[model samples]
Target: MTQDKHSRRRMLAMVGGALAMPSVLRAQATDPTVVGGTAEARRNISSFRTQRWEDHFDSLGVATLLADTQSRALHYWSADGSDYRLYPTSVPMSEELTKRGYTKVVRKRVGPDWTPTQNMLARDPSLKYMPPGPDNPLGTHALYLDWPAYLIHGTHDTRKIGRRSSSGCIGLYNEKIAELYELAPVGTQVRLI
Candidate 1:
């Protein structure tokens, strides 16, 4: 019985030591490269605004502007606002423009045109549509803003267009977003009110 207890104790001690080894090794791991890389990237992005739009205007011309209604903030970026780090609503237009490498061209107040049927479809994603186009819910074209899940686009529900009717999507005249789509590049800056 004593031998059996001793064997069990040894087994338990071995298991305990094995479990403790991982915690000790994890605590000792302090790689400067991993830590410094994140810090350097943040610093580089923060200093990005100082580079000036004039310095890189040729390459940094407006690529995309995002407007967020939830936060009531506008974010501009190159290649559909995809290249730069995200910013808060408090950042100034000039700073946002410089950071994203674009110049602010215009700020506008756009309204939505929503109807009962459209609301039903948006709320129920299961409803099938041919695809997003001129007649689609997405409208003729989509002008994405910084607002989460909101977009400015043409609507098939013309009657509801131009009124405060959308759940959040901006309802534009079918020809408007389409025409704007052609005039505005993939990265054009948008100012939202």
Candidate 2:
């Protein structure tokens, strides 16, 4: 009798799962945002696929940084092609706030400060300047791009790393930015797409 009960319970569980499978498949197909199985998994997800530098740039001058906003990942290649690193990043909150196309790292700074841009201030009058520290939005390191007010910088907030959370910058975790800062010299070619 015990064996029969156990067998029946197993059969019921299988039937229930089979009934739920269609809804699960439909959800996965219809929703682009649905990934993995949990909220934590979705928020932390960044698709890190292997990328060839030649596909993006003519040459790895100094180094190269390709920030793919769609995938929420940053790809790096060394000038000599000896090193490559992929980092999950926070992209601009919206496409209107994003700046695309080619640029280069024009400057590098440790302990970078934060000052709201005119547009930022216009949107939020409460915004003010912030000196470099734990609270600074730019975190520990910053690689200023050739475009005015654009940067590939670090963020103290780890939750922002794999989300669309930045104002207009590509943001890495502080530790990751520190490593990139060491490897990516000023003049590293950068592209945002």
Candidate 3:
């Protein structure tokens, strides 16, 4: 009877360790300085905290957007400082794919088309131009940044939100992008960190 109890305890211990292994692997794989996917990853990456715009911008000229790639959250403050909003976002999959610095919303587009970047084409030669529609990767609205080929846009793939899924652009949900598109006009100052 004692042997049977020990055997059961050993089995439970092995199962518990097996269940804990993924989290251990994920923690080791995650970079505290960069955003990551999954709820556990979020906890590991700063708990998706909110930040003040003043810390990122000298003034809320027109508007301000701070994309905290580390936390996978976007912070927005209106020009008048009366409105502040935070949204979960999908950041670049890797640090090399991320662009960190200040830029501005130079333009905005509704139902934007998707054209593979030069690097994207080089990687997948089969990639072709995609027109604006459900199949488009840019979703319902797009906020074009001063950096060419980089954007704060919507994605039809809701699964991408809160995950490290984008090639280089920051992605939001379709409805959220539409709302943001209406709020953030041209020349909204943006910083990606």
lDDT of 2 by residue, 4-77 (tens): 99999999999999999876654332122434754222122235444578878999998999998987899999
Highest TM-score scorer: 2
**Could you tell which candidate, 2 or 3, scores higher by lDDT?**
3
Instruction: Give the TM-score ranking, best first.
Output: 2, 3, 1
> Candidate 2, residue 49: CA error in Å?
3.0
Deviation of model 1 at 62, angstroms: 3.4
Runs of candidate 3 with Cα error greater than 4 angstroms are 1-46
Lowest summed lDDT over 10 consecutive residues: which window, candidate 1?
40-49
* TM-scores, each model vs. reference: 0.35, 0.80, 0.77
List lDDT for all candidates, in order.
Answer: 0.45, 0.88, 0.89
Residue 139 in candidate 2, Cα distance off native in Å = 0.2
Order the candidate numbers by lDDT, best to worst: 3, 2, 1
Error of 2 at 21 (Å): 7.4
